[model samples]
Target chain A: MAIRYPNGRSYVGREPNKKPNRQKELTYSNRGMTLEEDLNETNLYYLEKAIAVIHKKPTPVQIVQVDYPKRSAAVIKEAYFKQASTTDYNGVYRGRYIDFEAKETKNKTSFPLSNFHAHQIEHMRQVLKQDGIAFVILRFSLTDEIYLLDALHLLYFYNQKDETRKSIRKSDIEKIGHSIKIGYHPRIDYLHIVDAVYFSDKL
Target chain B: MAIRYPNGRSYVGREPNKKPNRQKELTYSNRGMTLEEDLNETNLYYLEKAIAVIHKKPTPVQIVQVDYPKRSAAVIKEAYFKQASTTDYNGVYRGRYIDFEAKETKNKTSFPLSNFHAHQIEHMRQVLKQDGIAFVILRFSLTDEIYLLDALHLLYFYNQKDETRKSIRKSDIEKIGHSIKIGYHPRIDYLHIVDAVYFSDKL
Candidate 1:
């Protein structure tokens, strides 16, 4: 039997290839949520509860052509998604500037440094230099473990990246990074870890 | 006589309508640049000078459909520009979180409150609560004058908006707001005014 597709007509006896099981694993673990979606939901929960105000910046795009059919709406006809020069998220929390990049990897042993762009590292370095709280939120999808690793420690490994392995070991992360306990309400309550790690003097 | 248009067919009688003298006036004043353009150029200048790190967040768009014709590029087939809940620009300045909205008006007498959305006012209020430096850069387009109005004064007016006038008078802005000197480089050096107004203690 042949199945028809939306964009074309189908011939008899030709079966569409079934894709690999990308959905099954994610459906089984972490309630089928990506780290970015989870963080967005968590940020919303925080915002609603008035606990903190943080937002993921929108994906940058280079708009080429736009058609304004009406005064109110603009239709982007030609646009390309551009690489962001800065981190994914930034906002003010507890009167302190909070800046961080979030990344998720399936690797069990180490977080690959390839996940970060050099510009992001430079941005974090600049933030740290200005006394702003800068860090990386690393999520191990295999273990569902999340860690907030300060930029200073990340910089140390980044500078020695040429000589050393291009990844930070999970053991090192567990030692230097602060583990955020996953919760029900705000799934990943990272601010608790931020308080303990960055504002330890006040705490 | 016939005129050939770029889109093709030649027209015999229809004369191309000339747009009003809007372009002429702008060309004569401030080198024909709008306030937003001026600020964006100023931001780039500041970034190049290593004076402060500030960036206008990309306009948020709700992408409904995208086509992946090739592996390298994705074409946005259908998208709508989304209303941003937060202010237009934000970043770290002197280790302080700077959050502000910039607006320009052709009105010479007053700046209308309608230029700002309710959510933007709320966002600024939240920033203020968290001790972030929150303000608005109001530009009187006709006079080519800009003023940095603090969030405190904004909040006061916002709270009494229902009972008060819908617009803030130019005299009021000049009295309560710090005037930013238009400059050759970094066209609107509002940060200089910020240092004077907010960080006066440090100065």
Candidate 2:
């Protein structure tokens, strides 16, 4: 299946011809779920159980020019981003702040350091200093495999990008990161990992 | 002087013409601080002293289409509102959850009930029921007067909207609502009201 990116470029995922039929669009539907939609569903399930209150931060946009035609609402005619965001989701979960960034890579071998921004690394450092739980949900789109890498692990590899010069190997990630099994109920049962990592020790 | 809305429609603020000139298209000096900017400044000051950790909830928008002009970034081309938000700000303060909505009204005699949506009212109702602090920060633009109206008082008048058939009177707000002194440091000085209303009884 082919997944088209924002740049009109497409990449083949796990099954070459397994693009699920959603209407007439021949887009790759990886079992009818994107990383965001899955996490959103998972968040809802967690919310219902009163496990955590997590919310996806709306993508921040710096609107440059706007045109309001009929006086209802302003329409952004032109805009530019000020900077890349630190994380994708943040919320109060069981009186503790939870912050994380979710990314999916088509590369089956390893996640690339280029997938993250320098500002995100800095932000994660600050979150850590404030005793907030921070992690990255990395999905190998080709294998449909997902892993939760703590900010410390991410920071270690991100810093190594300047020294070792290459990205972290798949073997290293597999060893260090917590593998999250995707399911039909919540899709990505990440809270189980959060429970095992964050809550259990505190309790 | 008329303050032009993005639509070129003019709206009456207290003193749009009072702004001292900076003489630039991109660098027009604002006469007074916006509610959001003031709240952010206030939050920063509070955070520095470990007084409270309050954050303005990011404005919610439904992004429809995006343009990836650069590989490193994505720009929102079109977007809309998903729904009305419940509150303006929420965070933890002294282990208690704080939630509130800030509004400014040009009308001096009374604050129009139209500012509070039905869904927001219901959301506040639930929050108050859950033993959470929910309130509204009202800024009377003409007098530069700000008041912290507790959710109970708001709900009382809101329920009587049909029976009384009138907007909330300024006199009533001044009577029941905790008057918050606007200051340059904290801007709204809302925590003082919070202290007086919620924590004072305990002390």
Top-lDDT candidate index: 1
Cα deviation of B91 in candidate 2 (Å)?
A: 5.2
Stretches > 4 Å off in candidate 2: A1-29, A48-51, A71-74, A82-86, A156-161, A165-176, A201-203, B1-30, B44-58, B63-86, B90-99, B119-135, B149-179, B189-203
Q: Each prediction's Cα lDDT score?
A: 0.85, 0.75
Q: What is residue B124's positional error in candidate 1, in angstroms?
A: 0.5
| Residue range A93-194, candidate 2, lDDT tens digits | 655667788998888777888888887887676667656778999988767788999999899888878756567777888899999987778889998898
Best by TM-score: 1
| Highest-scoring model, DockQ | 1
Interface CA RMSD of each prediction in angstroms: 1.3, 4.1
Report, in order, each candidate's fnat.
0.57, 0.14
**Residue A198 in model 2: lDDT:** 80
Candidate DockQ values, in order, are 0.46, 0.17
Per-residue lDDT for B16-133 in model 1, tens only? 4333355554442546788889999998887777677778889898888777886679988778888898998888888889899999999989988888888899889888887899
